[model samples]
Target: MKTLLMITGAALALAANPATAQDRSNDRAGDIQFKVLGTAVLPDGEIEQVNVDIVGLPANTQTAASDNYVPTIAVEYFVTHNFSVETIAGITQHDVDAVSGLPGAELVSDAQLIPATVTAKLHFDLGDSIKPYVGAGPTYFLWVSDKPGAATIPLGVTDTDLSDEFGVALQAGVDVALGDDGFGLTLDAKRYFIGTTARWFAGDVLAIETEHNIDPWVLSAGVSYRF
Candidate 1:
């Protein structure tokens, strides 16, 4: 009879603890965070092709070399503690010069492009300080300017029609947390695979077609805040 009475008293005591009950409720609130990042383009790529077909210039005498160094900004939102969505925007500038081996002919041209992208990311925590992640998505390119000189061909033989481009991205990064106050420092790397079609024209005359594949590397460091 005494054993039964003691068991009843212990059960009543366990049922009266309010702290344990409140902890379960707080666990369902989830974790949401925001981050801002800055990135720079790393020099990475080989010249694929350069085609020029204009009057008064040798058809096979034109070529181009790849350019690097681009800057970008990104804003990210965490849907949960381990998942996030981000949007990135940036601009890139390039300069190409044509050399004619046929005596004295020199030509130089410059171009620029701005691209905006949206991506989804997944995060993994390694402990209290380190978090590594990966991301992928799509992008749209806006052709800003295309300026060329007349020494290689003619003054009016400039191509400025580079249509919109489409591509995908891949990324990986690590975050180092600052204390327990939802603050951290982050370092990351990303690759974007983008391609576009370029059309050359002499006033109203269609000259040549060139396909451009731009694959650029990005390295970044930033800070993050969580709630």
Candidate 2:
């Protein structure tokens, strides 16, 4: 979060500079922007349903996934002065652990996920410097890799898999132009509604099959260059 704080500070500082907003003539249609950002991926990995639990999980079993911070890159194209399409690229890793009934037990480890998304946004022209926007779009979360946790390995578990799924996301953010030369700073937030199916196997036998709600709130702060 130290990186996030710094990004926020820089953006705020730039916004406070009176000279940065001196000109708004360059802000127009057909512009393409690219950004490098520090992002925080906060997810809720609670078990939502149990399709098959032959492993006999605890009656009140529940789980949680760890939050991760990563670097992300975003590309955006202006369809018009007030509309744009944007997408981001990044990979985040997490560990899921039992939080209740079987407290402290690790269920899955080092799950790497790539959130592939595209958003259509409506930018609200608030003034010369601040442009606030809202967006909604579809997202496909791809589970690149995952491993059985230490606790699961002893149960004769040989493999683990998390199903890739598609979902929707809502976004809101502000972009602050630093100068007319097309440099800016942005702070964006997105809420994703997504879920996945998890399976654990012992050689040829399926030990457990469960469904999970992996709703994640993605937050970002970055420097942008427009062309």
Candidate 3:
């Protein structure tokens, strides 16, 4: 009878240990991450004009650019071991020059704060060193620092009433574990598609509206510590 009692106690202790280990693993499943990101805009389509204003100039003049840069801050919340939700906030600066008309003439040189986006991502583990992810979500843009005097033309950007932009985010990267204590380095790349409208008054003479389609790609590298 004593031998049977000892055997039962050993089985209960073994069961308790696995449950405790599982609880510990669940506690460490979620992670909070921060990343510094750099982005470049790829301009394939023309900047569409919703409105236009010309003082004494011709109405046929329009401006375009080849490329632009956008840098951002990314914050991610891991919901599970291999899934997360991420939010990104960034600023973009563009130098818009009239394609055919100007000799060193800059039409618009300004910085605008891009809207923030929240994305739901699924991460894939490739062996022990590589992890890749993909996500899609909605974005909201807010325009800041519109200075009419800074441009060659007197076109005043009164406000940029940006709407809610729907976008998709794709990301892939590798995590280099530093040690067993949960310190690691991460490098990732992501692309976002965003669109908005710029509302402006041309020197109090005419009101012009412009629609901007911005597709930005982000590259980021950061360190993370898991507890």
Candidate 4:
């Protein structure tokens, strides 16, 4: 077959060149972008409570949360070509289980949530390599460090207090380009209506209290760089 006709004549000589007929990897007007991600803390099972008293506890005691895989970073600035403003630095880890048909006594806890976000983006031109976006803001959830299980709760607790969350963030994204330099590949999705309020201690005496409403759904992808 003559080597498949010399690979079909080099794909018709690179499709007849001419800068590939437009598609310069879009994003104009003072651009500055960077992204590196791999995260998913999806939890939309509806968690809520504002207060609770513990003393042999048993009054609506229920808690179960698990899902973690983190390592993310984002930065985007394009204040013109359709407006942009993005900032997100992340950290997520959660695993709390204490629900035994009732009467809280099978405790197991862990948490590490450090999130900071400020977004305001709306970009769309759908041409030169595709780029679509939509965003919303305010996400501050930092109540890092917490672990208290006391050997699966035999009473005589130690310490645990995790509370600090101020949320409201919505987003949608797209950006694909792997050619004309400037590198790219991004696909994001976020929805955090946050929640946190939990306390447990025995050394200083303040047994337990609860209020958690972590409505989360944060999915992400990686690789993107443009200047």
Candidate 5:
């Protein structure tokens, strides 16, 4: 959060500079912008429903997934001065641990995720150098791989799987142009509404099945270039 604040402050300061306002326009249609960013993926991994409990999990069992930080790349194409389409690429890893009934017990380990997303954005014209945008789109959360946690291994758990699901995302962000060379800074935030089903098997027998809410907030800050 501190990093996001610092980047946002820097972008705002640059946008307010009179020098940047006169440094050539950043309003070119049919242009493309690329960004390299540091991103934080914060997810809520609470159990929404328990479908099967052959292993006899305790009542009031709850779980949470760990947060992850990773580098990401974003590509955007301008359809007009105030409208664009954007997409991002990145992979993140997480762990799900029991936080309530069985505190500190790991239930899922090394879960790799790829969030494939695309958004159509509407940029509001605030000034020549400063642009703020709002966007919405669909996203697919793909699970690459996952393993049953150590705690579950003793329960004769042989495998674990997380279902790939489709969801929607809402985004808001600001971009500040630096100069005529098409370099700038950007800060963005996206909220995702998603869910997944988790299954655990022991020798081909379904030991557990659970429905989880995996909604996440993705935050990013980075430098951007337009061409």
Candidate 6:
């Protein structure tokens, strides 16, 4: 929570300064832009639907409520008057659950995910104030720290592994210039079609394996500086 506030404050400080709005030229080739992005992530996919993977266990497990919000930073460098390259980086920690209606039948699991992405962007010539852009690229997800819940220890589910994912990315956004100093506010939406393999443990050993599609849509809003 504190980190989110710090990001918001820094963006506001940069945006509120008069020196940031002095330049209004959006088509300046070779210009470099930096952004502090605040993202609200709603996780939806096949991977998130699975519950317990214990062998010979009763079915009817519900996996839900793992969505989260994340903050990130990005850099954009213009290659031509209307073309640019963009890179974004962020990390998230998800609290997951394996549950059923049977009394006291629940397990908690968590994972850490980091995404590194690069994209080629084409900006529309919409004068100096309204700049709309579209981009497509690739993303690599690094998954780590797949921790099994305490409750699972008694259930013979001892471990888990969430494999890294590779997928394509698509995005669209608009940047609205703030005053004349080149500070801007941006609204961006992106989607990633990432699929991965997961393995679960039973009897303190690897047992169940599943193929999962981690398709996630990311929507973000934030502040940027265009130089």
Residue 86 accuracy (lDDT) in model 4: 90
Write model 4 residue lDDT over 54-103, tens digit each, in one string: 66655555766677888898998987666679998887777666554353
Model 1 spans > 4 angstroms off? 1-38, 42-52, 55-71, 97-110, 149-155
Which residue runs does candidate 6 get wrong by more than 4 Å? 1-26, 45-54, 57-65, 98-108, 202-204
Report how far residue 192 has shifted in candidate 5, in Å: 0.2
Model 5 clash tally?
Answer: 0
For residue 211, model 3's alpha carbon misses the true position, in angstroms, by 2.1
Per-candidate TM-scores read 0.68, 0.88, 0.66, 0.32, 0.88, 0.77
In candidate 5, stretches whose alpha carbon ends up further than 4 angstroms from where it belongs are 1-27
- Clash-forming residue pairs, model 1: none
lDDT of candidates 1 onward, in order: 0.60, 0.88, 0.55, 0.70, 0.89, 0.70
Q: Is candidate 1 or candidate 5 better by lDDT?
A: 5
lDDT of 5 by residue, 70-153 (tens): 999999998876668999999999999999999999999999999999998766546667888777799999999999999999
| Model 2 C-alpha lDDT per residue in residues 99-206, reported as the tens digit of each score | 998899999999999999999877664577788777778999999999998889989999999999999887878999997888999999988999999999999899
Model 3 earns a TM-score of 0.66
True lDDT of residue 101, candidate 5: 93
Model 6, 1-227: lDDT tens digits are 24433443454454456454325563488889999999876654333344445465445544432677889888999887566899998887765454353334334366778877898876663565887777778999898677765656676677877788788877778899999887999999877778766677875566656566566778899999989
User: Which candidate number has the best lDDT?
Assistant: 5
Model 5 quality (TM-score): 0.88
Q: Give me the runs in candidate 2 sitting further than 4 Å from their true place.
A: 1-27
Screening candidate 4 with a backbone cut-off below 3 angstroms (N, C-alpha, C), the clashing residue pairs are: none
Considering summed lDDT, which 10 consecutive residues are worst modelled in model 1?
A: 19-28
